[model samples]
Target: MLATTRNTLIQLAEIQHQLQTIHEFFNKWQTNPWGFKEEYLSEKVLVRFLKYETESFANREWEAHRKEIDLHIILQGSERIYLEDATKLTEGIYHEKEDYYLLEGPSNHFITLSSAIDQENSLFLWPTEAHKTGVNVTDEAVMVKKMVFKIKY
Candidate 1:
């Protein structure tokens, strides 16, 4: 798993893509609802824009992907995201088409959503990591707008 900012994403030579294309396209998606649903940024990269309210983790299951890297970029609001090693969690039945499985266990590590203020607004989770997201930062609920990039590796 990796944690970095959007601008840093472009500077990393490791990720294969036209950085300008993604940055430009991202700006467009942030402003218009027409670009809301999941869309392909490249042959192996897909982006999904979503908005929802933060909630308690009481009964929610952590999730891990088998075939993609999840990069979550928070556009607005704040929340806490819990992440843990996949091996520490109990096994879960896999859903072939969706490519993910829900895990059961406690998350011992987490990162509160960062923004422009911290220069690290994005979190990356690979197949080796399990995470429970959309968690409230406080007792009060907060609305969040985020973009998730699903990249097959």
Candidate 2:
């Protein structure tokens, strides 16, 4: 898993290049809803712009993908994301269409992200990493808008 910001992007050309199309996509959808056509980034990449109320960490499940990497960028609010080694978790059957596997048990650690930090605050999870997102940082549930870029691996 990789946690970074826009400030560090210039130094990560190899990774940033994979996300180049998102910059224009963000600009074009500033006022648009979360929905978009499947595979917006390219033939294999799927971009999901989602907005939802933050939930308790206990309510979220740890999920890992087999063929895609998860790129999470917080655009509107704050949330804590928990990550764990997929190999350590009890895995459920993989969902081919969604490209993710359901994992049981807690995570090894977590990180928090918010829009105030920077528009580029992002987290990338590889196929071996399981993560639980949408957990609130504070006591109250806040609405969070985040973009999930599913890049084919």
Clashes of each: 0, 0
Cα misplacement distance, residue 112 of candidate 1 (Å)? 0.5
Per-model C-alpha lDDT, please? 0.79, 0.79
Model 2 residue runs over 4 Å out of place are 1-17, 27-39, 118-120
Q: Please, what's the RMSD in Å of model 1?
A: 4.5
Tens digits of per-residue lDDT, candidate 2, 79-149, equal 88888999989999999987888999876598888889543468877676889889988899999988898
lDDT of 1 by residue, 1-153 (tens): 556787756645555563444677778866874745678888767888888888998745789998887889988898789999989999699897878998898865888985558656888776758999989878989888888888776
Give candidate 1 regions above 4 Å deviation: 1-14, 18-21, 27-35
Model 2 local distance difference test score: 0.79
Per-residue error (Å), model 1, residue 81: 0.5
Quote the positional error of residue 82 for candidate 1 in Å. Answer: 0.3
Model 2 Cα displacement at 41 (Å)?
Answer: 2.4
